[model samples]
Target: MDWQAHARTLAAQIVRPESRWFEPLATTPRHTLVPRWWDSVDGQWALQDGARDPGRWLDVVYSDRTLVTRVGPVHADAAAPGTVVDGLPTSSSTLPGLVVQMFQHAVIDDDTSQVLVTTGSGYGTALACQRLGEQRVTSIDIDPNLVATARERMNLLRLRPDMKVCDVTGKLPGAYDRIVSTVSVRPVPASWLALLRPGGRLFTTIAGTGLIVTADKTEDGGAVGRVTPDPAGFMRTRQADDYDNPTREVWEKAQHADGDSVSVSRYPLLYVPDSWAVMSMLALDVPGIDHRVHEDGDQRTVWMLHPDGSWARATSGGFLEGPTVHQGGPRRLWDALERIRNRLNREGQLPVYGARVTIAPDGETTLSRGGWTVTL
Candidate 1:
């Protein structure tokens, strides 16, 4: 089976009918960029030896699922064929569908345009280079090894983009007509606005949420746009491991909460990933909302928690009993959710994708919709 054929099919699945990325996605050789990857199995990430499974490799490689190409600081190139390291997925060539959607948002012009995209496994960089020539693209990544490997991969295809080992969270390499980030960001880095020329567009995913923002650079050093209705999960920009091993006390409480303080809930089950509007609204309003989804046998569980000491759990249980909720911090978790829901009830809809963003030069962000404004 030709991996190129598979890549074409994968691209079709991701590119929208009205998107211009279709032609590029269909022609680019994505498998060459992601020669080997790590796959999740048994709740653990294991190395998937592409060379060993050459026959089945293309199937996994082109699938919409994320393939981890680096662990912690270790690139998959250094590891042996069967080596498996479990730290955290540090880098990857994001799923094809997501890449296409992001590019679609970018709205790249075919008339002598330059775009800056974060170089991960170089798959996205390859796509951009394929769409817009190598000279028209500048790809940067924080990890030097990733840049080096990506350069090699691009060289193999004879498609050389300006691959640089620079941190996108800081200064960008050069001015660009469009900037698209695969990595999620807590705040739209001021450097992005500085890099973009006037009338330029910046497309990126909001860190810690599934919100996709497409903003245009304004003359006053700010950008604004309505959130994309499509939901996505980008690896959060990390200085290091972005997780903490739960303390014994916290673990115990999560496993066994006190009664009355946490009563069983009665709410319809909703996956945050599947609810772009509600999730985006919550992200803007609540700010720091962490979520975890657990699946046991036939049951699915979702836990939503905010930094302000509010938590909600919606199990597979019926809505009559409500959700197992706990709130004691400054901001009430369930109350906040209920408030958003009540607004939706009264207004007949929630403003999430429609939320307007005003990114200031000082890096302050304000999200407003229907007269309600949240600043972060």
Candidate 2:
């Protein structure tokens, strides 16, 4: 397959014609970085090998979609054929368009400016290297194996950037003029501000939501900015080999028990992750809600479980119908969600995007807009 031609075609579709990133997107070979990945099949992850089906491989690689490269420390390249892992995704090659959008947010105009990016499959790092030389780009990942693999793949294309294995929340290897994270983080890391040069900019998403913050370093060792109008979401940053799996005991209880309260849902069932504004508001107000959905024929069931022993299960026969909800524990999970929905209905939209953001020296982030305020 003519991968360069395919990349050019993809570049034309995704990159703005007048943008400086068009040439970089056109020339980068994404297939080299993502030779194997995982695909979700029936709510489970299935390995997809590019060498096994080159035609399908070329199609998926050139298309605008995220390719899951690792799930619970199982890199797709090392997995056997037909291997299926029932765990959350640990790393991925983010969609090319989103990467370009993030770069655009960073406003990398001068070639002399140094930038630090999160290395996934090294695809985004390759784009950065193409625009600014390898000397100006540094990419890091928490997984040592992923960093090594990405370094090897980039070598195949003769595109080398500084690749390091370092936890994003910890101290960085060097100072940078711009820090752009493709992974989500909670309570903007103070290390980022300390490592960034004065007048440097940082772009990242809030954990569990699509809130994209773009802040420039301030003189007071803090940063002040606003959430971008555009929404972007990414997997949370992990410090260990793998994220902790949900406790089986908590899952069993949330799945079977009818708790302290039972009532009819005031609003239709909502999968909070689907909506940018709704998810951002809910995640900020009541963080760490594990959501799951099940569908059997005409019936659909939605479950919301919290680590704090709060759980809510709602079932409905159709999309428009209200769900019968059962709640247990100290907090009413469904009631909190309903209140947010009600507020959204009243205000027409949640003021998460474009909200003014203030980050203190101690990593406290305050987001405010209109008359609402939330501090993390």
Top TM-score hit: 2
**Candidate 2: tens digits of C-alpha lDDT, residues 215-250:** 888999889999999888899998876888554456
Lowest summed lDDT across 10 adjacent residues in model 2 is found at 241-250
Off by over 4 Å in 2: none
Candidate 1 residue pairs in backbone clash: 265-321, 265-322, 265-323, 265-324, 266-321, 266-322, 266-323
At residue 260, candidate 2 shows an lDDT of: 81
**Tens digit of per-residue lDDT, candidate 1, span 1-376:** 4767787787678766455677777777777888888777766667777778787887888788778888776677777766667666779888877776687788876774889999999988888888788899999888777899889978998998888887778877789889999898878898898888898999888876777888888889888776776678787676543334333233344443542355453345666656766776777677666666787765666766655455555566443445555544355555666676677778887776667878887667777778777776
lDDT of the candidates, in the order given: 0.74, 0.89
Candidate 1, residue 83: how far the Cα is off, in Å: 4.8
lDDT score for candidate 2 against the true structure: 0.89
